[model samples]
Target: MKKIIITLSIALSFALPSYAFADQAACEAKAVSKDGKPLYGAAKDASIKKCMGDAKPNDCEAKAVSKDGKPLYGAAKTASIKKCEGGK
Candidate 1:
């Protein structure tokens, strides 16, 4: 059991870095404009931020739910809709 645990731990350590690199590549792929040009510098950063942020739900009404699983109400719901729509 001890030897199996150590081998699995070593294998996971090597696998994790590759997963991180793949995620970075995926983020870069998503950081392009609608015209197919890749964004760079501040543009790339902003694009990535918007891309990742919008991954949750594209619709404003869908994003009005709180992190705790409760639906937002009143000003909170309105604010969420505005922010989600503006990001697009």
Candidate 2:
């Protein structure tokens, strides 16, 4: 029992910090990319949230004046909001 408890504690000690750091980093990256723009992250997964948000998923114009931008074209807009993963 003591050994189990110790092992669990040790595992949590390492896992918790890494998890926290990853989330923070994801948020930081999103903020940097936003660059005055706005975005949200997945409440559950920092990476998933970051990926979709970074993709800039919707309504973004390719040319604004005369071009059709696709999803992968990047830059989230109204239509792209759906691509936000969790829609944060």
Candidate 3:
């Protein structure tokens, strides 16, 4: 039991840092990558482009959909469509 406990503790030490350091709130704001993988922890809008292959933030749109792949603004890509979507 002593050896088992030590082994588990060592494993948790290695794994916990990566898991504990992530901020869940920031990750929710930005949608996942093109391949449908959630980006790590809630990052600023610009961070959406980083850690997911280092693309320029401005190069991509803020996704017409939410992180869960729901159409936020329908098929509309224009300001008018956005206004309707936002119920403005």
Candidate 4:
């Protein structure tokens, strides 16, 4: 049992950092304006905040797909969609 717990803990430590970095990248990518210009200062912050807040499940469908081309389901799907949508 201890080994299993330690293994799971180690796996999660590696897994979580990737998700965090991915989310930061997504937020930065979404912080741009529709006119192809990058926002700055409070505007950039606001844009990132809005983009994350307005994220929807459908918005992340493409990113939420499984390796076999099937849509993900349940919590995994939800987390994937949220991550893709730039939500924390």
Candidate 5:
């Protein structure tokens, strides 16, 4: 039982880093420009950052709902989205 547990733990440790790398790779693939060219420099960095933030299924904007379940608007929505997305 102990051996099985140790093996599973090892496997999970290896798998988790690859999962994060996959997200990064996918985000990088999307870092293109409006002219159909790949972005470079600060633009590429910013694009990848935004893309990674949106890779999650329930992203910050989607979670910016009011207490009554209605979608938030204006400054309220901005704050909610920022908080939900790790205050970025």
Candidate 6:
């Protein structure tokens, strides 16, 4: 039982970091502009940062609303969330 527990713990330790790295790579691959161009400098940094789960979770999503209190949709919501996440 002790050997099984130790083996399982070791497996989980390796699995967790690889999973995080895979997510990070996916985020980096997605760091591009709307025009299909790759982002550079601060933009790329911000994209990766947000994608790697550095953003304020649902705070920005909840704030995505129009002045008239209507929920923002599509590009507007995306832009709003990006801005709230400290991106350009």
Per-candidate total of colliding backbone pairs: 0, 4, 4, 0, 0, 0
lDDT of 6 by residue, 1-88 (tens): 9999999999999999999999988998999999999999999989998788775749889999999999999999999999988884
Please give, for residues 53-80, the per-residue lDDT of candidate 2 as tens digits: 5444233333222235443323434334
Candidate 1 clash figure, as a count: 0
Candidate 5 lDDT (Cα, 0 to 1) = 0.85
- Indicate whether candidate 4 or candidate 6 has the larger lDDT: 6
Overall lDDT per candidate, in order of appearance: 0.81, 0.53, 0.53, 0.81, 0.85, 0.91
Query: Model 5, residue 20: displacement in angstroms?
Result: 0.6
Q: How many backbone clashes does candidate 5 have?
A: 0
Q: Model 6 clash pairs?
A: none
Which residue pairs in candidate 1 collide?
none
Candidate 2: misplaced stretches above 4 Å? 33-88
**CA-RMSD of model 4:** 10.9
Give the local distance difference test score of model 3.
Answer: 0.53
Question: What are the TM-scores, per candidate, against the unseen true structure?
Answer: 0.52, 0.36, 0.27, 0.49, 0.62, 0.59
The better-scoring model by lDDT among 2 and 6 is 6
TM-score of 4: 0.49
Decreasing TM-score order of the candidates:
5, 6, 1, 4, 2, 3
lDDT (Cα, tens digit) per residue for candidate 5, span 1-88: 9999999999999999999899999988999988889989999999988877754536777888889999999999888877876665
Report the error of model 1 at residue 49, Å: 3.9
Which wins on TM-score, candidate 4 or candidate 5?
5
Instruction: Write candidate 1's Cα lDDT for 1-88 as tens digits.
Output: 9999999999999999998678777887988878999988999988766655554454778778999989999999878887777754
Listed per candidate, the RMSD to the true structure in angstroms reads 7.5, 13.3, 15.1, 10.9, 7.7, 8.5
